[model samples]
Target chain A: GAGVSQSPRYKVAKRGQDVALRCDPISGHVSLFWYQQALGQGPEFLTYFQNEAQLDKSGLPSDRFFAERPEGSVSTLKIQRTQQEDSAVYLCASSPRTRTDTQYFGPGTRLTVL
Target chain B: QQQVKQSPQSLIVQKGGISIINCAYENTAFDYFPWYQQFPGKGPALLIAIRPDVSEKKEGRFTISFNKSAKQFSLHIMDSQPGDSATYFCAASENIRGYGQNFVFGPGTRLSVLP
Candidate 1:
């Protein structure tokens, strides 16, 4: 409510297992984004949605990485067939407008692939 | 390819000193630049931002300097405090003739402020 929120702050999955992370954006936000951050590195863009429309997904590492904002208020990022390299912090951010604006980020989900 | 480049992988500064972090980008189309600050186990927060139209912008103790010709920008924290110790990232984005814009972030700079 106050800001962006993410569920399952931490996740541990075995190789080949599938996992889904959820994000709840600020109320009435029009833009949502997902990013992956590896150890000691900055966040890399994964996908972006504008009011339930998947405008861009070119940054997703692989086809296994899929994201959806069906209702536009909430979003989910599902990773299928996880690999060791998939272990990283997944971040969700929301902006008030569809155009460039200040984004509020959630705590992020730390996915550890064993 | 890395669209954004940052210098000084890590920095240590004393309290009350000026802390500076630099970043460069190759894409001239990037018109918006923002700097984010992050703490351990937390998400990044928007510290300050600047547009290409202005050469510099200041808010409180933070300042963003932009060099349009060189496609470079930097963040300056005045009177650094120990509480300011964190990782800083510089990001750039262009208006993609679409509904939303994508961001390109640079390798972060870890700053430690000594009290």
Candidate 2:
């Protein structure tokens, strides 16, 4: 009955620093997704994973953003050389299949790069 | 060219009044539309969803009206209450891979219901 959860609810990093955000999907869920939400804006897709394989990562802003889901359970979104523009809430969601099915979202990790 | 455009940015309604939020999408391949509700410091929660097959779907006091020809959709909340005050987002989903989906979200509309 537990929903998706994210860690380090808040993170403040200096420019050029590296940060890794973690996401734990719901039990038995087969689909995982990452999104970035800016202030006063809706969330934009960052990457998606089906089981341990990443199906789409075209939404990733740049090469600095890397995500991996090993063992088909937990996922980590890593941002290398953080920039001021990277400041936003990173959201993770899990679903049984796709967005057609209801996806449960995590509280999100707010990252601020100064 | 995949974009879900939401309008009115914000809305304020009195108790018992109706609240309506509209969204238009450019992609016709989108087959699933869902509305998400979010409160401060919380993740978005699914409010209602509609498939292209149906013109309209109503759940409790929330209703989703879909216009397939117009490529638009709207959310109507009846007897809006203060508890219903939150940000609403309209999203379009299209399945790309075997089980992968692409979600295009609107800018979002902040709704404030006065007591």
Candidate 3:
């Protein structure tokens, strides 16, 4: 309740199956971001949302990757037709307001595509 | 695409010793540099940060040294402790176009502090 929270800390999905991850940002936070981190690597930005508007989805790897923040508080990342290479940790972060604001991060959801 | 490169993919340091991690960026537009500490099963958290305007920033046991001309920066952990062992990541971003929310993080350095 005090920090960002994510659902289904671990997910095991078969290849070609679809999966969705959820993120609940800090209350009153106006910025949210999603990132994908592969093994032994840092987080790579996947998308960004400013309030309820999806400002950027340039980082999404493919059309199968979709994200939406309808209310500006909770967000979801959906991956369709998942592949083995899609296995990675999905992270969610929220900022208070401005660009310079400190970002609070969630524990992240580890997606395993088998 | 902006890239942040971090070195010493893995490190082992003794307790009370100083641990240093280095990072370099290719983008000149990046004005915000931040170091994040992440433990297993947890997301990375902001450890310390330094802007290009300043050459150095110190907070308690952590220090960030920035070199504008070389586009390099480093994180120094003074008196490293076992509890400090974790993965450290360096990230860069620009405030332009509200893109600050999208940070380009380095490959990360896994630090192991031995007691």
Model 2's CAPRI class is medium
After the best TM-score superposition of candidate 1, give how far the Cα of residue B109 lies from its true spot, in angstroms.
0.5
Q: What is the C-alpha lDDT of each candidate?
A: 0.93, 0.93, 0.93
Q: Pairing residues by index, what is the TM-score of model 2?
A: 0.97
Candidate 2: Cα lDDT at A74: 95
Cα deviation at A6, candidate 1, in Å, is 0.5
What TM-score is obtained for chain B in each of the predicted models?
A: 0.97, 0.98, 0.96
lDDT of 3 by residue, A1-114 (tens): 999999889999999999999999999988899999999999999998989898899999999999999987899999999999999999999998857547889999999999
Which candidate tops DockQ? 1
List all candidate RMSDs to the true structure: 1.0, 1.1, 1.0
What does candidate 2's lDDT look like per residue over B11-92, in tens digits?
9999999999999998999989999999988889999999999999999999999999999999999999999999999999
What candidate 3 gets wrong by more than 4 Å, as runs, is B98-101
- Which candidate order results from sorting by lDDT in descending order? 2, 1, 3
All candidates: DockQ: 0.80, 0.68, 0.73
How large is the interface RMSD of each prediction? Answer: 1.0, 1.9, 1.6
Give the clashing residue pairs of candidate 2, or none. Answer: none
**Fnat of each prediction, in sequence:** 0.77, 0.70, 0.74
